[model samples]
Target: MADQLLLKVRTDFVERVTKPVISGLLDDLLDQKVLQLDEVDEVQDRYTVRADKARCLIDTVRLKGTKASQIFIDSLKKRDGTLAEQLGLVAQQGPPGDQLPPPEPSVGIQGQQQWIQQCSLSEYQRIRDKEGDQLPHKKDPLHPRTAESCLSLSSQIYPIHLPRETRTRRALIICNIEFEHLSWRKGAEADVGGMTELLEGLGYVVDIHCNLTSQGMAVVMKDFADRKEHCTSDSTFLVFMSHGVRAGLCGIESGDETTDILSLDTIYETFNNKNCRALLGKPKVVIIQSCRGGKVGSVLMSDSKDPAVPAPIATDSTPAGLEDDAMFEVHLESDFATLHSSTPDTASWRHPKKGSVFIQRLIEQFRNHACNSDLQEIFRKIQYSFGQFPRQLPSQERSTMLRKFYLFPGH
Candidate 1:
């Protein structure tokens, strides 16, 4: 009998031999809905199958005396020497019409059968190793049930797919230009008009209130927070323009003798989920364009013949909550953000004819980038625009947010 020697095929040739066989098997599996292939790379002889489906394929191929492995080998044999030659596994077939020598008598049928068996084992081992690597790992610590529940709750809390309806958009814009004894804000009216136009263009139905006292401001905030419209809205904006002090925004009642103001923390708590369930899981954007302190920002002047003249200064400056009731259940608050015009203990600048430096830059930046950027990103650009001036830096505070919030202007 001829020597029973193993035919060593190149690894590349082995890979080539298994490609078509595996592809055919995958097609059958796919047709039966037994497996799903998310992605496939025919050139690399690799494909990604759904995790569960991969295990099914492995189990089916590894059965005792399984004919699937044999079927793969038989398919390769049917291709004759074409696949082998393509992968350089065997010598190239002779030119067409070239007669070959007859086989020797010692080359028995049993020897050929043994060679076929060896080839089948080689192909099976290669596939088993490759498929085994594709199996999903059991490294995740979280149980599937816990992960699924988390995903479900997250989707419910933050539904990004909901339409941006303009009719549902709401904003409370309070501009305090006239003070009882304090100097009037030169450009506060302009700030209010600009904010109204900008917010209305962005789809908000703005409620403009001029010259509100501290008590009036509190009443307005509570009423707005309790409105049913907020329940159907995706987001809301609260803009306050007035002279302010470090302690809080100065109201009309604020004067030289005593301070009449609203606490910032109180304003935040009023719109919180605990107090305002209607706005829960929705973005509440509060923008304050006012002086946060008594100091004024000044710039160095270049040498000139003109006389030095005094420049006007600007100033800064909420709070309310819901009554507890036995029948109402409290929900955790989230997704509140506050954008202050000036940093703490610093003065915000404004022009007599134009608006405050912060509001002007804010309107311009939002109009330019609102369609493409999120609210946080737009605020960053606004802050950068104020970098040229001295003592004017905007600040922001954010509560826990399940998902990013976008203004989606013009939507």
Candidate 2:
């Protein structure tokens, strides 16, 4: 049964269990003879990644059956009490009579005491037999594929009290390609459509708005932040795509040198804890896919390569903005991670028929990796992708999240 419990929480445990705990667990298991010396060596030397080491350690222990598995979990309580509690180990511990196996060699009371307390629980943990490896998952839209749960992200940042029944994850996309006085952002619709599908697949009720002024953008931001849906929501994402400059993002009527902008500082304040209490401690993902300036210029790489095809035709710049300097109101904003398409004051490139290079790459990264990697990790991958392309580089402007954020797509 303990092995069953370990199996159920395998993905979560491997993701969050720290490296030090894995080493300590190995020592304890070796002391109690649950794991042979060679098995421990295999976990330590054969596995390269920390998470890999954890997976190996747990699998090795579980194969020793109920007694060894119970000891491993019990030792977890003494070694890393916080993680034990998070995994429901402390609360769901088994009966005391199911003692650990006798040590193969004589070891001190310390090793015995580590797992001896497992017998000291007031409540019995309920054990249910999972049908099979093939979990009868009837495609739930909110939690799509039976993927890794966010509990592995963090027990603190992710709310335990807010059950799935009460949650309403929401996302917003604002793409301003058809400027009133500027050139049409030729392939921006591709970005919006791709992004919408990604967010919707993650179970968010996405709200899409196109071509708005600075003031209009502010109004929508304010309304979205103040919505009642967020009261029951777990986390939110906001993506803004448009022409931009050093000052801020350009509105529909704004062009180069104009002041009609939705300043980044305004966005920070709108979602800060003081302004938006509902999202105070939750993740507020912000993605800005627009040109920061005209310095780097545009590159329009065509999808087709033919002698008759015209040269590359597009860039994301028209009117512009960039990351704003810190404002006092938003200086201590919590739980916000804002990623910009380009470095401050540089133009981000676009394929006239596809989309901005940043957005298109982001779409690829999230679709392929969101199921396993945390949001920050995925963002870093997107940033790393631009290292090969000299024209533009994406920047993670601000991150104040308290813990890791996994989209846990289809889950």
Candidate 3:
């Protein structure tokens, strides 16, 4: 009956709910064991818009059955008596008889957005535009990419969570273009600007650091891992752009010129489950736009005329829980996907004014397809785009994700 009551008032709830109330109710419901940690994260991180968050919160609570719904209603009554009254919710225990002051007139808290970082997605500019290239195409506005009912992957039904809109959607970018001793990564500013723009469009507050040394890179990653924002983010993207050696990224330093280097292993270890508790069980995406070695990327080219199509991805089937059970032990490190600019022991190409070919393709692929494709799929498209260009090939490695990650661009 309580669930029905909530279901009946759903539209009104969505229309009238405010951020403070949502935040407060989430804490209370979570403390009451009516909602799990991952579930709370699901509501807060998945959607960016206030109304969307409200819709999800109520639906999640109501589905838990009568007790949960009643708790939610009671919590609502205390937090915003006027709206609660409008929804016909009376504290089961009538307002105290003079023992407590009357329910104060609705704090009339004029509803306002909780997270207010304004973002304007930037344009993709390609230098020396390939005369016949289709990329860096004309810009198109990003529309919201809604999620399907369910997502099946690897014989598991890991629901590709919906991207309704949430309070915290953050991204980190470290671009090393200028160096004290090394030549400037000439067009790197283009990559920096382009990446910031595209990610902001995808609802991320891009935290950028320019010209960090190897040690500095480690510090930055450590700080980012500890940020409070991750508590409310369903997924995150960490990007590094700079010169590099086979061992790892060549932090604002060139080979043999400086001792600075941020090993690839350190980056992963810094964000692993033990180190980054805040991001545990969430999608942690990494993009590296630096050369791995001095050698050319192409090796054995296929002489056969047959086209190279990617292997077919598996379909979804089994039904899984809303989140990993709170009690069950999960893998120490999972749900991480890293894309490298060039394969190991190879060099990646870039134009002086355009930036790394990898970053440019990133801007193109994500801008064009992110609204409809999951992150993994978009990465695949990027890899394919580099197929004909024999100089370099982006490689996807160290991926441990269990679900399809949809960005839902505009929402």
- Report every candidate's CA lDDT: 0.56, 0.69, 0.67
Tell me the lDDT of model 3 at 222: 93
lDDT of 3 by residue, 1-411 (tens): 565466557657877899999999999999989999998996788655676578669867865656888788877877888998887765446533222223322111121121112212331111112211322234445633223312222222122234435447668888776565655666776676677656655666677666667887898799899999788777789999887666677665544446576778788788888899988878899999876655332332211111222223243443588454533323656788999988866677767766778888988888677655667889999999998887778999988886666554444
In candidate 2, position 317 carries an lDDT of: 50
TM-score of each: 0.55, 0.55, 0.54
- Cα miss at 116, model 1 (Å)? 72
Candidate 3: worst-modelled 10 consecutive residues by lDDT: 123-132
Residue 282 alpha-carbon offset, candidate 3, angstroms: 0.7
Backbone clash pairs in model 1 (N, Cα, C under 3 Å; residues 3+ apart or in different chains), count: 6
Candidate 1 wrong stretches, greater than 4 Å: 1-167, 297-332
**Per-residue lDDT of model 2, residues 189-262, tens digit only:** 67866676566556566776666789879988998998988888879999998877655777877854655778
Give the C-alpha lDDT of model 1.
Answer: 0.56
Q: Which residue pairs come into collision in candidate 1?
A: 244-315, 244-316, 244-317, 249-317, 291-315, 291-316
Query: How does model 1 score by TM-score?
Result: 0.55
